[model samples]
Target chain A: MGHGGGGALSAELVENVFLPAFGGRTLAALGDSAALSLGGARLAFSTDSFVVRPLFFPGGCIGDLAVNGTVNDLAMSGARAAYLSCAFILEEGVETSVVGRIAGALGDAARAAGVEVVTGDTKVVESGRGDGVYVNTAGIGLIPPGVDIRPQRARPGDVVLLSGEIGLHGVAVMSMRQGLEFGVEIESDCAALGGLVDAMLAVTPDLHVLRDPTRGGLAAALNEIAAAAGAGVVVDERAVPVPPQVASACAVLGLDPMYVANEGKLVAFVPREHADGVLAAMRAHPLGAAAAVIGACVPDHPGMVVARTAFGGTRVVDLPLGEQLPRIC
Target chain B: MGHGGGGALSAELVENVFLPAFGGRTLAALGDSAALSLGGARLAFSTDSFVVRPLFFPGGCIGDLAVNGTVNDLAMSGARAAYLSCAFILEEGVETSVVGRIAGALGDAARAAGVEVVTGDTKVVESGRGDGVYVNTAGIGLIPPGVDIRPQRARPGDVVLLSGEIGLHGVAVMSMRQGLEFGVEIESDCAALGGLVDAMLAVTPDLHVLRDPTRGGLAAALNEIAAAAGAGVVVDERAVPVPPQVASACAVLGLDPMYVANEGKLVAFVPREHADGVLAAMRAHPLGAAAAVIGACVPDHPGMVVARTAFGGTRVVDLPLGEQLPRIC
Candidate 1:
C-alpha cells in the first residue's frame, strides 16, 4: 500500500497502478510536474504532501518543506511558479500557536519563492488519528516560451550538474531524532530553488533535464532519469559533493550518502557546449555555490547508472527497494 | 489547532490565520474557489483533503470524496474543471488492496466528471504515525466569459434553490461508524456536481451563487452566504426537503437535520426573474431531480437566516461552532 521509496516499487506502483487508473497522456509521462496546455497557455501543475514527523526540525520545518518541495517540482518543468493552494490536516489537541508559527514559516517561504497562496482548505482529525499537522500544497506555474525540459530530453554528451552537497537534509533530520548527534549540528538544505533554476534558464532555456533528489536521493533521481531517457549515466564518485560532516554522519550510521535525500538541491543535464556557462551561472547562486559537474550521460549501457569509485573500480548504483530513511522530507 | 467545522469557529480561523497569512485579492473574497487570470486565461483553482475516518463508506470512499469535493468547489466558481492533482499520505501496514480500491473509485469519479488526473504524489508514514489514508485533491478549471459567480452576489430579492434532499451523506457515515441502521438504509449522496452545474449554466450563465453543502449542512451553507452577502435569508421550513429516513435517523441520533452534511447537494441563489428557468434546468438533471426553491434573500435582519416555522413563528438558523458529527465527509 505504501512503497514510495523511489525505487522499483515506486515505479511499479506508477506503471501498474496509478497510470492505468488515471489513464491520461500527460500522466503517463511521469515527470515531476505535469505540463499541459490550457486555453492556449502552457502551464505546469503539481502537488505534494508533507508528513515529516516532529513538524519542526533543524534549519527548517514541515511548513517550508511543503512550500519548497512543490515549488521545486514546478521548477523542474521550467515553470515560473505563480500560485499555490495550501490544504492542511490537523490533529485535535495540537496547539494553535504551533499552527500559527508554521503558517508564518509557510508565508515567509512562499513570499521568498515569489508565489502566492491563493486558495486553501483546512480539515481536522481526532487526536491520535493524525501526527500533529500534515500539509498538502498544489501549485500552478507558467512555462516560458522556448523552454523545454524533460528527463527524456537527455542526450549522450549532456553534462549532469548537481546543485550542492548530498545527504545534509536526511542527516539533519536523523540527528534530532531519538537524541542522536554527530558531534556537529547539520541543518537541512531546504529552500525554494525557483530562483536558482531561473538563473540557470536565463543562461540557456534549452537544458535537457532537471530533477530534485528528494525521496530516494541522488541515486534514485539519477536512476529514474536514466530509465526514462533510455540512456546510461556515469558519475565520478569523488566529484559528487558530500559535506564532511554529512559524510561522517553517514559513515557512522551505515547509510549511503548517494541514497540520502536532499530538499533544495537539483541535478541538471545540460548540453556539453553550454555546460560551462550554466555551471558558472549556478555557482553565482547561493543555493548552488557548491554546484559540481558530478556526471555525464553516456551511450554505453542504457537504462542504468554507474559510479567510478576512487579505488579505480566501477559499481552499479541501483535504486534501493525502499529508502534507508523514511519521512526525511 | 483544528477548527474546520464549517461553523463560527471555522470562520474565525479563516479570518484570524488564513486571511492574514495568505492575504491577496482573491483570497479576501473567500469564495469556494479562487478565480484568477493566468497567462491571459481565466482559471479557477481549489483544493480539499479527505480525512474521513473510514476509508470506504456506503456510496463512496475517500477517493471519490477527494475528487468530487474539489470538482464541486471549481464548479461553484462557474468553471468547467479540466485537470486534477491527487496526493496521498498512507499509513504503513495498510492493505494494498484497499489503496487499489480507493484509486479505482477516484479514477471512476474523475472520468464521470469529464476531468483528467494529470499529476500525483504518494508518501508513506510509519505505523501509528498516520491514519489509514488521507487524500488531497487540487483541481484547475477554466471559467467562461461573463459568468461571474460569488457568495457576495446574493441580492435581497434573489431566490434560493436546493438541489435535493439533505442529511443523507452525514447519516450514511454515521450509521456505519456506530453500527446502527436507520431501518431504511440511507446511502450517501456523494457525487460530482460539475455536470449538474453545467446544466444550470446552460439555462443562464449569470446565476448569482452556487455552493455545495459539505462539512456544513444546508443551514450552515445558507448562513455563510447570508453573512458574506450581508443579506438576510428566509427559508420556508416546510419546503426544505429532508427525506423521511434521514429525519427519523436524525431524530433517533438526537441530531439536527439542518446541520447534517450533504455531499451531492448544492444551494443556489438566483435572481428572481431567472429562478423558473434555472429550477427547470436543475430538475432536468438527475442529481437535482428534487430541486426546490425553499428560501429567498431578504432585507430584514441582515446577516441572519430565519426559518419560518409551520406555526407562524421564526427561528434563527445560526452557524454551529463545529459539526455535530465529526469527519462525516
Candidate 2:
C-alpha cells in the first residue's frame, strides 16, 4: 500500500484499519490533531515519526524534525504545544557523539519552540535491524477558548492561504542524498509553526482550516480539506510561491514542486470575511513572511482541487499514489 | 550498547547522554512516568517502544506489550491511563494480515485497559530497513488528588510488595524460541496494571513508590528506587513468588527468576502502617493475586539490595549490566 503519501491510500488505511479498530468521536474527526477536553481544559494531542534518511540534512536533522513536526501538528488545531515525548530507536553501533549531537539538536529545537521535552524513551536494536535512528514524538498542547480549527470547518468562499514557498525541505533532503548541488544551496524550511499559528489566530478566532504541507505536500493537504469539507478548491498557479533554487532543483529532478514536501509551510483556509486580516497577520510573522492567498473554496466540483496555470489552462491536482520523495520529512 | 537490558548500561545512556541534552526539572525526577501539571490537572506521561521478535509469544504479542507497557508506566505514577498514541514502523514486505492482527490485538488490549488509542502514526520503511514491526506507544494518565508517587519517595521501613510471580514473560518468549516446554506451559504475564493500582490507591493515597519489574525484572527496578531514594532494599528469597513452571524453565535455562522479566507485575513501597491494607487490596485483583511482602526499605547499605536466602545466607542483588533476556517485553 502507498500509505506514506498521505493520499487516498493513506486515508483508506486509516479509515478501514485504524479507525475501525480505534474509532471514537475524537479520533473520527480525523483532524491534524485530536482535541480532547480533560478536567475542563481543552487539549490537543498528536504524534509523528521521522524516518528521514541521511540523518543529517542540509538545514535540519531528524532531531529538529521530530520536535517541530509534532509541534506543528498540535499548532494546526489552534493549540499551544506545551510538552513532547521523544522516543528514539537507535541502531546498536551508532556513535555516541552522533547520538549526543542529535539530542542536542532536539533540545535546541524544543527550547526554540517554547515546548519542553518532558518525557522520553530510548531503545537500541541490533545493528542490522534498524537504520541509524528513528524518532517518534508525541505532543500535548493547550487549545485556546472560543477557537476552533479543523478541516471540516472549511466552507464555500473560504480563502486558501499559503504560508510561504514550498519544496525547500524536499529539495534540501534530496540534494544531500544525491550529493548534487543546483548551483545554489537549498536549506530545509524545517521549523516550528506554533508561533505563526498563534499570530494567525490573533487576527480572528474564525479561521476555518489549518494544515501543514508535509508528507504529501500542498496538493494532498488541499485535496484532503476539500474532501473532508465537501468543498472544491481553485488555485491560481502564479500565486503559489516557489523559490527559484528549489524550482530549478525540482525541474532537474523531474519533480512537481506542488506535490513536494515542506516542513515549515502551512496552508490555511480562512472565511472570506476575515481573509485580509488573517493574511496580514500571517505576513507579519517571521515564519510566514511570504504568505499569500492562492485559492478559494467553491461549492461546485465538491471534493476536488484544480489549479489554473499561468497559460490559462486548468488541471486537476490529485493526490499522488505514493510519496514522490520518500522519507523526505 | 546494552540498550535493551534496562540495566546499568541503559541507565548510563540515559544519565550520561540523554539527560544532559534533554534535561528539565520534571525529567530529572527519572520516575517510571513523568508527572506534569496542565491546566490544574496533574497528568502522568510516558513512552515505550516494543521491538519484540516473533511478533507473537505464548500469552501476548507486541500489540499487548506496547499497550500494557505504557499503561503500567503511568500506573506506577498512581495515574489512571486515559489515552495512548500508537505509532507503528512497519517493514514494507510484512504481510498486511499480520498488521491487521496486531492492530486488532492492540484495540482489544486498549479496550480492556479502559484507555483509548486517540491518535496514531504509521510509516513503512523499505524492506530490510526494519523488522516485521516496531511499535511505539506514548500514554497520558491523570493522577488523582492527594496522590504523589515517585521513585525518590521510597524510605526506610517502607514495605516492598511484589504483585505476583516473576519471570513469566521472559520465559514465555524464550520458550517459543527454544521450542521446548516445561511440564506446565508458561504464559507471559503481560497485562495492564491500572485497575490493580486503582484498587490499592483506594486503601491509602500515600503509597510511596510503584514500579513494574519489566526488563531487568525486580532487581533493576529495586536498584533504581534504592539509588534514587538513597535507601537500601532487603528481600526474603523465600517470600518472593515464582511460579513452579517459570522456576523450572529458568532453572533449565540457567536463569534466575528474580533477574528475568515480568510484564504485568509491580513492586510497591508502602508505609509500614498501611502495608497490610495495600497488600489485601493488591491480592483482591486477579493480576495481583499472588501479591506478597517480599522486601523492605532499610537505612543500612543505602543504594544497595540484598536478599536473605531461606538457608540463612545473604547475597547482594545487583543490577545486571545488560539484559539477560533481550526483547522479552
Candidate 3:
C-alpha cells in the first residue's frame, strides 16, 4: 500500500522519520508534488533506481545512495537541486527497523542536499518477487543562468578531467557482497556533489560537459561522451586517478580499474584553454582534492575513446557489450 | 540491473518497438525523466510499478496495462494528463519481439489517454532475480484551476461513486496466474480513465476525492478515504456495481467482490448535492457507462467504512493487512 495512507504507519514514517530530518514547507504539504518558486529558471530533471545488494554497505545504504545519485546527476547538468520524488519497492518480511534506518537516512540526505522529498510511494512485493528493497528517486533542479552544459557540447580540443579517485564505490560494494574484508575497511565513495560541483561552476562557468561514471565506470562513460559528441577521447594512463586499495581490489577480482564504478567522482570535458582553471577549481574543493587532467578530446578518431597504457600501448575503450555491474545505481 | 539503462538495448525497446506505435513529441526527449510544459497549470505527478505475471494475459499485456494504470492514477488526482516516464525491468533471455509488442501497446495506451511517453529506460536482470518483465511508469499531469481535490476533503454526506464494473483487473491476473480459465474468456478491464474523469469533472469540478481500486481493490481504497478524512463510509452492498462475470470469478475464488481490483474503473467522492450530475456525466463516457452511486460519507463512525449487506447484515471494511496481489503493481 502507498504510504499516503495517513494511518498509524504513515504517521510513524512522517512524524518520527521525514519531518524531524528534511523539513520544508512544500514537503510538509505532503502533496502529490512539491510546488516550488523556481524564480523562472529552466528545470533539469533526472530519475534513478537504486537496488544495490546487501542493502546496507560501508559509507552508506540504499537510502542516502538513492538521494545522492539523483542529486549528482542533476549537478552534472549544472542544475541547482530542488525537489525529489521517492518510490520504494519493498520485499515483504523485511525488518521494520531496516525501513526506519533507510527512511531516516533519506531524510538526512535530502536535507544535506537542500532538497525536499515531497512525494513518495511504497509497494510491498512477495519475498521472492524482489530483493530486499529497491528505491526509485526522481527530481527536478533549476539550471542557473550562464551554465550551459551537455554531453554533446564537448569539442575536439577539450581536455578531460577526473574529479577524484575511481573504483572506490565498486570495490566497497563488491567487498560487502562477497563478505570480503580489507585491513583498512574500504569505504564506499558514496557522496553528494552539489557543493563541489557548485565550486567548479563558480570558477569556470563555461564548463562544457560533466558526467559521473557509476555503472559501466570510466571506460563506458568516456565512450558515451565520445559517441554523443562525435569526438575521440585520449586518456593518459599515468594521469588518471585511482586509489591504491581500490586498484588492488579490482586486480584481485579480475576487474579493470578503468571499468570499476565510482560514486563520488565526475569527469568533465572542458575547452583546452580553460582546463587549467577548471582543474584548479576542482582541486580547491575537499571532495575534488585528487582531481587531475587525465585526458583530452581528439578529432582524428571520432566516436572512439583510447587509453594509453603505462607500457605505451593504446587500446580503444568501447562501451561494454553488457552491463558489468547491475543495480549499482 | 535496476532497469534505467539508456543504451542500445533501451533504445531497441523504444525505437524498434515503442516509436512507430505510441509516438508523441514528449516521447522524443528520451531523457531520464519526462520534462513537460504542463500547459501552465499546477503540475500533478504519479508513479506505479507493474510486476504482473504471465506478461500477456486475457485482457492486456504488461505494457498497455501499465500505461493505463499510471495514467488512471494521475487522472484520479483531478489532473489533466501530460507526459510519462517509463522504466522497464526485463529478465535476461526474454525475447525482443515480446518486448517490442509490449512497447507498441505502451504507445497505443498513451495515445488513447492523450498523453505522451516522453522518456524511458530499460535493463535486463538475471532470470531468477526477476519475473519476465516489470514496468514502472511515472506520470506528470497539470491540475486545472479551482480543482483542489484530495482524500482529506471528504466530509459527512459526500457521495461515493463507482465509475464502472469492478474486479475485472484482479480476476484477469488471478486467472492467468493460477492458469484457471473460466467457461469463456473474461478479459481484464484495463484502460485509461482520463476521459471518464474529465467528464466527471465537467459535471462537478469540486469532487472531493478520486481513486482507482487496484491492488487491494475497492474495499481498501474506501477505507483509506474514510480514515484520511476521519469520516465514516457506508456503502450499500447491492449498489457496488460489479460485472456478472467478475462476481462469478470472485465467488469461485472465494474472494469478496469489494476486495477485487479494477483497472478501467474509479471510485470518486463528490459533494452530495452534485453527485447525480457527476454520475450522469460519468455514464456518458464509454469507459464509465456502468457507473453507479455506491455509498456516502457519514460522521457517526469516524475513520471507519461499513457496507450494508443484501441480507440486512453489515460488515466493516478496512485496509488490507498484507498485499493481496504481491508484485502485481
Q: Between prediction 2 and prediction 3, which has the larger TM-score?
A: 2
Clashing pairs in 2: none
For model 1, what fraction of the real interface contacts is kept? Answer: 0.65
The TM-scores of all predictions, comma-separated, are: 0.98, 0.99, 0.84
* C-alpha lDDT of residue A144 in model 1: 96
Q: Model 1, A1-329: lDDT tens per residue? A: 22866677777777877787879999988899999899888999999999886789999999899999999999999998999999988888878888888888998899999999999988888877788889999999999999989899988999999999999888899877747787878999999999999999999999999999998899999999999999999999999999999998988889899999899999999999999999999999999999999999999799999999989899999988876887776
Model 2 residue B267 distance off true place after TM-score fit, in angstroms: 0.5
Inter-residue clash pairs, candidate 1: none
First chain of candidate 1, TM-score? 0.98
Tens digits of lDDT, candidate 3, B48-83: 667777788787888888788878777877776766
Evaluate candidate 1 by giving its C-alpha RMSD to the native, one decimal: 1.3
What CA root-mean-square deviation does each model show from the true structure?
1.3, 1.1, 11.6
The fnat of each candidate, in order, is: 0.65, 0.55, 0.05
Worst 10 residues of 2 chain A by lDDT: A1-10
lDDT of 1 at B93: 85
